[model samples]
Target: MNLLRTLAAISSMTMVSRITGLLRDTLFARAFGASPYTDAFYIAFRLPNLLRRLFGEGAFSQAFVPILAEYKNQKGEEATRSLVDHVATTLVWATVVVSVLGIVAAPLILMGIASGLDGDGFDKGVVMTRLMFPYIACMSFVVLAGAVLNTWREFKIPAFTPVLWNLSSIFFSLFLVQYFEVPIYSMAVAVMVGGVAQVAIQIPALKRIGMLPRLSFNPLSGLKDPGVRRILKKMGPAVFAVSAAQISLLINTNYASNMGGGAVSVLQYADRLMEFPTGILGVALGTILLPSLSKANADGDIGEYSALLDWGLRLTFLLALPAAVGLAALSTPLIAALFNYGEFNAANVAAATAPLMSYAAGLLGIILVKILAPAFYARQDIRTPVRIAIGVLIATQAMNLVFVQMLGMGVAGLALSIGLGACLNALFLYTGLRRRSIYTPHAGWLGFFLKVVVAVVLMGLAAWFSQAQLDWAGLRSHPVLRIVALLAIIALSAIVYFAVLFALGFRPRDFMRRAK
Candidate 1:
């Protein structure tokens, strides 16, 4: 498979979803603004989303895909299909049980997670959480189907499925806000709708591939399958590793909740913005590279596997480094331009900017980790990453306590702690890869990375100057003008970065050729 082509396709789809998500968030900020209600909604939303990442998307896919791929390779199609059916059935039942418990214990969970939210905020958060908890079950199934499709080399549907989620959220935030009476609660409804849509979108593709898994209560069928058992066993440790990072996020939210109304919302908005690029580049790379790496490892093609790993790392750094710099440089202007409307006030803008900058600083590390973790998982080495992730989580929490409580940095502190932990995690993963002889940096990687850094520095300076010029020209006074100015700056930075990279021996054609 052409890694670059796969990344391109995934990136294009993700860009659409990211833009739609931005529109949804914009509508959210306009309607709800940075208030206790908004904060409560964010807190309620975070729990399910965090779980989705940790369990449904992260650990489940990491552990399940390699084993699934191995089954497809070693056993016949019938055997692989049987394993899918059993695993899907079992996972759905498990998620349903867990979702029910979560709904019933919503209040207790909210209170534990955000003990500082007082009065109406706390009450509303619990209500909203209960309403949205079913999303965990819906998305868990969707993710399972997605993993199956991805392992089958049918990437487009799963990659495009997220558009449904973003569109549903945007529609609710826009059209349903007035009808629902309780506007914030409508967003929760949108989430459940989105989850259903996400699952629905994948069914036809599963049918087209003739791999639509039938739901059954017969757990014994796939339970005895070696691949299924192997995936399940590795899944335990993978969950622990991924949960470490997610737990840090929960801890950060707990601290943010105590900072009064809108803190959680502010942090969430900043995170969404940061996620735009990461999802487009980091996730696209990881998703595409995983099956490729798994296939190579399965065939004992270590050389090809190592080459893909190197390419994945370079692509991540090349794409994410400039994004981090550009975002950090233009955080406030971008936030103000996109969100300074309706109920979203200047204070909200101010609050969101600092944390966005902090997140931007760690953007490369975060994306690198995302790209590298699949390498370990592809080789079925889950426990090492899990152990490292646990260590990182502990360090992150310790830093969060010092920064949030002792240093009094609030959301920015939380962002800093996460960024710091990501840096540590990425370094550890790279070191482990080196020790295992799974990956070694190509001879040109250092020079290429240095060139990227130089290009990013140039881009950052250009963006900063462009922002200053726009400000001096009073462009920011008008929303349209501010948006236009922001776009112009972004365009200029991208051009400069690409041009400089090309001139510095970075070959676009070579990258594109590799994709072919």
Candidate 2:
């Protein structure tokens, strides 16, 4: 598929998922607020999410997809199918053992991560963490299956799988909150169900594609498979690289947990908002480009690979730049519109807005890393990124300690630390790419970037004026009016930015053209 068309498909589905996720968080904030229970719940929820990013989606998908694509390209479909079955069986057995251990040792894990919570709150956190721990095992398998489908160019099912999680969470949060009383724990149950549903939804798609992986205990089969072994080798370091990022966030969360009752929830909500754009634009581009880059590399078409990388980077920056600007400009209004209801008060909105703005600062960096890291992974040079990622992780922890303890900046400090780390990671990766001459932008790229920056600035100004008008009109008191105003600001910003870019020598048709 063409890059723009693929991105459109992925982004449309991801946008729906993100919107539903926002609704899920909206219900969660109203029902649970930022109480100790909610704090504990976020910690518990983050554990599975961390594992999903580290082992399942982030590392495994990055490592698996390129290799699987190459296998299909080289040895035909049946050989790739065998490799998938072997990897699937091996992954299932390993995940089952890990899940058992996780359930058994939940308290120790919870205490280690969230030792700040006391009394029944601490106990409940452990209980919730344990209840949701099995989700990691289940979702990891789902992600593996999804990776297989993505390798086969079946992106729709995998992209839509997250919708199940969001919808399930929203349903349970709305209905079960009143009946269950402990809505946070109820959400945990919903998460487990969602994970199962996420996996189940992909089965028919896989079967229809005639590539449903079967069970196979032959370790030698996978280990001996060149494609599988190649991915395994790359995965070892890529896991560390992915874990470095997640571990940094985990450290931030741990610090945020100790800050206050609501700090964790504030960070969580702000992060959810930031992830909306990142998932829709950055992740969609990365997912599409990985296979394309891999195919280019496999064919020794370095020019095509570089063109794809440059195009991906340009599109990522174009999309994420305005999102970051808008978020930073309208953090308070956006937070209030989405979250200022039920138990979520104005003070809570203020707390969340600060971190949202801080995260917005590194939005480009975040998306750049998402774009660039795949370039390295597509080249099967995962170790270099891992090395750089370790440095980034250490820097993140140090910055967090300095910001949180020395400066007393709370969750916003943690957000700043993450942003700083992402900036450093992107710079290091870009520098490495330059050293290898693997990626070089065209001369006109700088002019394109400048035009984008100008356009984003115009969008920011428009959004600011719109937000000020809404505030002056006192619409913030009415949730419906406030939400409508925020959506309008978003819509206007997008329209103005695109119009400015198109007027400033950026052709919409040029973006639609195929890479190289």
The TM-score measured for candidate 1 stands at 0.97
Candidate 2 local lDDT, 1-516, one digit each (tens): 677987899899999999999999998888777778888998987877887788788888889888887888898888888888878876777677777888898888887777687788888888888888889878988888888777777888888889998899998987776677565678889999998998898789989878887876653555666766777777788887756767888877778778878888899999999898889998888888888888888899988888888788788888888989988999988788888888988789889988999999888888888889988888878888999999999998999879888998889989988887998999999999989999888668778888999999999999888887655224446777777777888889889999998899788677774743
CA deviation > 4 Å runs, candidate 2: 217-227, 472-477
Q: Model 1 over residues 435-515: C-alpha lDDT tens digits?
A: 999997778767787898899899999988878665522343588878887888899999999999988888866665242
Q: Model 1 misses residue 436 by how many Å? A: 1.1
CA-only RMSD, every prediction: 1.7, 1.8
Error of 2 at 162 (Å): 0.4
| Best model per TM-score | 1
Off by over 4 Å in 1: 218-224, 471-477, 513-516
Q: Cα deviation of 228 in candidate 1 (Å)?
A: 2.7
Residue pairs clashing in model 1 are none
